[model samples]
Target chain A: MSSVPLPSSRPALGLIGLGAFGRLIAGPLARHFPVLAHDPTASDDSGIEGVRLTSLAEAATCPIVVLATPVAALPEVVAAIRPYLRPGVLVLDVGSVKVVPADVMRRGLPAHAAIVATHPLFGPQSAQDGLRGCRIAVCEVRGDRSRRVAAFLRSALSLDVILTTPEAHDRDAAASQGLTHLIARAMLAMEPLPTRMTTRSFDLLMQAVEMVRHDAPEVYDAIARANPYAEEVRRRFVAQATRLTTDPVQERDRAA
Target chain B: MSSVPLPSSRPALGLIGLGAFGRLIAGPLARHFPVLAHDPTASDDSGIEGVRLTSLAEAATCPIVVLATPVAALPEVVAAIRPYLRPGVLVLDVGSVKVVPADVMRRGLPAHAAIVATHPLFGPQSAQDGLRGCRIAVCEVRGDRSRRVAAFLRSALSLDVILTTPEAHDRDAAASQGLTHLIARAMLAMEPLPTRMTTRSFDLLMQAVEMVRHDAPEVYDAIARANPYAEEVRRRFVAQATRLTTDPVQERDRAA
Candidate 1:
C-alpha cells in the first residue's frame, strides 16, 4: 500500500470526543493539523493550543472528522454528524469493537463521505510515546480516500497498519484483548494481592495487571460481555483448565 | 533468625547434579568457593576454574555440602553422602519441593550434620543475570551452623531469604512454581507461535516461554506431579476459569 505524507496545507481535523483518548490524540494532532474539536462534556482545550473548540456543525466543516466517542455513544454521535458532513469528508472512528461502529458509520454518513473504521491498539496510557512502532488495525476501508487515510496513519504516525475486515478484527480481538483482560480479572479475583513475591509466575500476573489496570472499567466489561466471539474463547480457556484438573495425565499428553 | 557471617576459610562446595540449574549454581559457586563437582552426564565445565572432579564420597568431605541433585535422585544422593558426612558439616539442598528432601535429609543423614532445605526461586534461564535480587526460601533450618550457610547465600550471593517450614514452603511452591509452569505449558500448547507480535499479551506469553523453555522435562513433570499440595492449587485455578465462563457475575462480584 502506498503511503501519503501528512497534507502540506495542514488539513482541518475535527475530533468529536474529548475523553482521555480523544484528548490525547487531539493534543498531539493539534500541533500538525488545524484541529477543530467538539465535545459535549468538555468546554475548551485547556492546555492544547492552536485547537479551535467548535460546535458539531462547525467541526464537520473539516476535511477529516474523527469520532472518538465510546462505543455506547457512537450511534448518537454518528447520527448527529450525518447531516453536517461535507460530501468528501473522511470520517473515521477509534472505537474498540468495529462491527457495530462500522455498520453505524456506513448507514448514517453521507453517501459521498468515506467511512473508515480504525482501532489504534494502544490507548491513552501509551499515547504520550507518539504511536511509534505501535499497531493500528484498519477494518472496512470502503473508498479510495479511506486508503489514503490509512496510508497517512502509517506514514505520519509510524504505525504498523494491519488490513483486515471488521469481522476478522472482532474475531481475533475477542481472543487477544477481550479474553486476556477477562483472564486477568479472573486471576485478580482468585487471590488477595500477594504481600511478597519474586517468582516468574508472579511477574507474569503483575504484567497482566499493569496492562489492564488503568483501562476504563466499561471498556473492559464491553469487550468481555459484548463481543460475540469472546464467549467461545472463554469457553476454550475454561475447558483447558478443566482438563488440567480432571485429567491431568491427558492434559500433559496433549501438551506433549 | 540470627545470621552468621561467612568464615574466612570458605569450605569446599560439592554439587552432585549437573543439569541446567545445578550447573548454573555450581559454575558460579565454583568461582567463589572451592567446588568439588561431579555429574554422571556432563563431561566438561566449559573452562570454569577451581572445580575439581571427584566421587560423591570425596565431594562429601567438604564441611559445607550442597545436594544440587534432581528431586527424583535427591534421596539416593542423601543416602550416598550419609556415610561420609563429618561432624559440624552443613547439608543443604536446592530443590523446588521441600518436604520430601527435608524428610530424606532428616532420616538419612548423620546426627552430627545439620540439614537445611532451600528453594532458590529462580533457575538457570531466568537467573542468567545472576541472583542479585532473587528470593530464596530456607525451609526448616536445623542448627546454629545453618545460619552461616544462609548468610553466605544472602550476603555473598545477594539473595533475599524467606524463612519458613518445609511444609509451608511446599504449600506455597505448589501454587507458585507448579501452577505457573502448568499454565505456561497450557498456554504455549494452545497457540501457534506468532511470526510477529507486539501486543502485551503476546509479550507476557513470550516471557512465560522464556522462563519455562529450558526447564528439564523431568523438572516440569516433578513440579506437576510430585508435590501433593499442587493438585488443590491447580483445581482452584481451574475452578476460577470455570466461574469466569459459567458465572461471570460471580467472578466480577468476587473481584469487586
Candidate 2:
C-alpha cells in the first residue's frame, strides 16, 4: 500500500547479469535508481544504453544488488559476491525457480547482507508491448526489503506483486512454465503444422507454441528439471495423453 | 470471384438439423433464402428466429437442403431425405469430418441430388461474433452447384472458403482438430490447474482448453477415430512428449 521511499541520496542499483531478461528490466529499473551492471561474458555494455558498466566487486557493494545469473550458476555467483557485499546491502535474485537460488543466496551471503528472491513472470517476448500490469512473484527470504521492493514494483512499475513463499512460487510455476515449454517444444518437433484452415482452437495452441519455440534449450531444461514439481506435472500430462490415445471405446464415439 | 445469381423466385433453404450448431447457421442462411428447418428432437422453432419449423419431408424438398445432422445420424437422415430430393436440388452437409459424410451423401442420395460436403470451422461458441470471415472447408462431390454456393458463402456470408478434397480435408482436420481436443481433454484430466499467476503461454493453452472442454464426448470420439489421420497425429504427439519427458540429460541442462 505504501510507496518505496527513495533514499535522500539514491544509491546505484547493481545488476549482476546482463542476459536478455536482465537487460529487459534494466531500463525501467535505471529510472528509479542509477543502474550499474556487471556481466563477465560481455566485453562492454554497448547494447544496454541506460545502465553503466562496472566490475562485479563494485556492483556487489551497492546498496541494492540484483543477481540475474542463470539458475545453475547461482552458487558460484553468490560465492563470488559474498566477500564484497556490505552490511545491510539487499541482494535480490531474478531466478525463475526461487527455492534453490534462495537457498544458495542464504548459504553464501553474510548474515549482515539481505536476500530476496523475485521472479518477473514476463519476458521480452511476452512483454513486448510493456510491463504494466505484469505479475512478479516475490519471496522474502531474510529481510523486510521485499515490502519496499513490492511497493516500488506496484507503484512505479505497475506490476501485480504476489507475495508468496519460495516453495509455493516454485510449485505453481512448475506447472505453468513447465507444461508450457514442454508443449511448445513437443509441438515444434512436430513442425510444418497445418497452417491453412485452422480452427480457433488450433490457432490458440499455435499462438502459445510460437511464443516459446525459440527459447534457449537451457530454459526448457531448467523448467523441466530445476523446479521440483515439474517432473511430476510432466509425467501426469504424458500419462493422460497416453491413456486418451490408447482408449478404443473412447475413440469410437460419433462426433456432434 | 462472382456473386451468386439470385433467382427470380428465391427458393427456401432447408435445414435438416436444428441443434445448437444448426441454429447458428440458420439466421445467416435465412438472409439469402427463406429458411425452413426440421429437427426430430425439437418441439418447435422457438429459440431461433428467421427459420420456420417444418416437417422432415417438406424441409427435404427445398431447392437447397443443408444436412446438419450428427455424424452418427447422417446415414439415416440421408436415407430419409433420398426420397424427397428432386433433380438439380443442391444438398449440402455441415459436418466436421468430410470423408465419411461425403461418402454418406454419395451413397444414399439420388443421382439427381447435387451433393456438397462443407465443414464450417467455427461452431456456435467461436461463431458468437457472427460467421463473417470464418473458414469453411468445401468438398464438391457430385456437381458444379458447389461453385455457386462457394461464391454465395464468400460474397454474401463473407466466409473464407477453402476448396479441398474429402481426403485432404479429413487428413489436415485430423491433425488440427484432433490435437486440440486431445490436449484439452488431457489438461482437463489434470484438473485444478493453477488458476492464478499464469504466463501468456499457459493462459493461451487454457483458452483453447476452455473452448473444447464442454464439447460432446461423441465429437471427441469422432475426431479421434472417424478421421483416419487422427490416430497417426496422436501417436506422433504422444511419442514426442514421452521422449522429451524421459530424457534425463535434456531435463538437466541449465537455462540461459
Interface RMSD of each: 2.6, 1.9
Please write out the lDDT profile of model 1 over residues A1-256, one tens digit for every residue.
1122334587888889878888777866777797888888776543577666778887876788999887778778888988888878888898777787888888888788887898777776544567787777887555766567668777877778877778878787776676567667666655654434348655775676567767776567556765667778778777776666665546446668
User: Scoring model 1 with DockQ, what do you get?
Assistant: 0.36
TM-score of each model's B chain? 0.88, 0.92
lDDT of 1 at B174: 80
Compose the digit string of candidate 2's lDDT tens values, residues B12-91.
78899887788889888877787878987887543665677788888888899999878878999999988888888999
lDDT of candidate 1 vs native? 0.73
| Leading candidate by lDDT | 2
Q: Write the per-residue lDDT of candidate 2 for residues A136-171, one digit (tens) a residue.
A: 999899978899989999999999899999899988
Among the numbered candidates, top TM-score falls to 2
Candidate 2 lands at a TM-score of 0.93
Per-model TM-score on C-alpha atoms: 0.87, 0.93
Inter-residue clash pairs, candidate 2: A218-B255
Q: Which stretches of candidate 1 lie over 4 Å from their true place?
A: A1-9, A247-256, B1-9, B44-47, B193-198, B247-256
Docking class of 1: acceptable
